[model samples]
Target: MVDQAELELFRDNVRRFLEEEAQPHYEQWEKDGIVPKSFYRKMGENGLLCVDQPEEYGGIGAPFEFSVVVLEEAARMGFMALASNLSVHSDIAAPYILHLGSEEQKQFYLPRMASGECIGAIGMTEPGAGSDLQGIRSRADADGQGGYVVNGGKTFITNGQNAGVVVAAIKTDPAAGAKGTTLFLLDTDQDGFSRGRNLEKIGQHAADTSELFFKDMKVGADKVLGRLGGGFGHLIDELPRERLVLAAMAVAHARGALERTVAYVQERKAFGQSIASFQNTRFTLARLKSDIEVHQAYVNECSGKYQRGEMDVPTAAMIKYATTELEGRVVDQCLQLFGGYGYMSEYPISRDFVDARIQRIYGGTSEIMLEVIARSVLGR
Candidate 1:
């Protein structure tokens, strides 16, 4: 459960932080293609980095709702790229350590991560694999020194360039398929670990997305995450929460675009009249608002389920697919309301539109989400 008053207070703080610290510099970062690593440390100082980990690790250890508030505020401010980076560190990577890491691993990394001194990245997708985790070609064979020598590369890795540590997925036995998959936490400064240049994209320029290569990178056996051959299971266990937050982000993004469009339509004139006075404009925005409200409620329900530990794979897939698809549609419709200005890079809607595109691709593709949903309905 969440305290409504506290949540609102936190939302105010997050919004103020962004307006003062982030928004003014966001466009510049977009041009730079990466947020400064020092900015992350600043976020730690503000206690805005990771809000939900245990206090011993320098986190507030607040309820998951506090994190939800952070996510919503980020998206509301149109800071999607930065929000995604923080979520990856706080929600995605840290949980693996909290749940599966040895005491030494937890002690060494969690505090640094919580303080934003060490950014975290997860390596699961390879050149040949995206949704199909079982198809990854990265390999890790045992070294007689009680460690594994990792070989192969990961592409489209979020936070790759800036991450101090990475939880890499590798195949311990290629012939064993998904059962052969293993995860190892490696310090990126280690010998033979390299990062490729930041990949250019249509959007999300501020977020560091890159290709990571491991050339016989050595990781001690103690660095293995979870049980041997249980990497797939660990990933599966975490997918629902990941997908759920993505859904929430989608809804928040759409709401941001829609709100901006609402204000734009009222002020922008067309054919000697305000566009808001036109029937078509009213109907378009009305439909979009209605759709957003309905979807927002569903996402809230899903979030509640997640906090209760009742979120399931199929439901998570459904929300991910539905909300992301809805985000695309809502943003497109909202952008259309801006007419030519929407197409201009100067307009915030343009960024929102492009950023929404990747929501469907990562986390899980729309097609993959459908497959997961269909399996639940048709019996897998």
Candidate 2:
């Protein structure tokens, strides 16, 4: 567990790093369509990338709570793309190596990953597969040598264009259903691995969401991430953490947006009085403040449960679904408070409005979360 004083110090350090290095240039990065790799290396120098990875792997070995603190702070700075990218590298991608990779793999990958010398991505979604893992069509066939020949494509991959290492999900036995799934840790510099275009989106313009193609890409047996047939289970095992981080992001985003909107209304006057003084604005903000506090408490509880290793899929899904849905509603309401300024690209609320839309889409759709929760309750 991270003590309060230590956590406070770490938070302050992260804030300084962002204000000095990230926030000033974020709009340009959005226009550039990616955060430069040099900035990632800078994060490494500051020991901000992977806080909870084992010390042997160049991490600080702090509790997972420390990572949550990083995510919350990044969100507070309104850098959703950077926050999402780091979360994918730290929480989603690195853990696969830490928990499942061979010692050689861990030693080789984790250190560079910790230092941001290597960025990581996970390839789970395909043109055909988004919510359903079993629906993926990418394949990896044994070549009768020590390696396998891979031929498939993945879409909507986070950190896709810039990843040095990617944990790719593939089907080893196409006829065997989910039992045939496998994971390969591929180095992007290898032959036959090519990145597709950096996808354009309505928001998260700074994030490197893209498509990846493997045309007869060959990976040695040593590159296989987990048991060849265990990929589905591997994804399931790690999802609690993924969903938990997304839940934290949802709450943090809502909080930041609410705080900013409150400040905006209080200062801007209308009808010869501050908008905040209007009864309608007060009621709207009052309800939003109460909802944000309630949701934050639930998120905090979920975070504690996760750190204790007691978080289950159902609860993670519940918070992810609830908090993200709440994020959308809150951002929308807050944008309304800004009136015309909310729609302007120069306003932070405009970015928040669009960026919050994806929270329900990725990390499993809100509909998928509801289905998972329904299964638990109905036992069907």
> Which candidate achieves the best lDDT against the true structure?
2
Q: Across residues 75-147, which tens digit of lDDT does each residue of candidate 2 receive?
A: 7677888888989999889999998999999999999999999999999999989988888898989999978
Cα displacement (angstroms), candidate 1, residue 144, comes to: 1.3
Clash count, one per candidate? 0, 0
RMSD of each: 1.0, 1.0
Error of 1 at 264 (Å): 0.7
What's the lDDT for all of these models?
A: 0.88, 0.90
* Per-residue C-alpha lDDT of model 1 across residues 1-380, encoded as one tens digit per residue: 77889988998998898888898999998898888898888888888766888888888988777876777777867888887887788778888888889888999999899888999988888878998887899998989888899999999988988999998888998999879998889799999899999999888888899999999888889889888988899999989878888888888889999899999999999899998999989999899888889989998888789889999999999999999999999889888989999999999999999988999999889999999999999998
Angstrom error of the Cα, residue 292, model 1: value is 1.5
- Residue 232, candidate 2: how far off, in angstroms? 0.7
In model 2, the Cα lDDT at residue 51 comes to 82
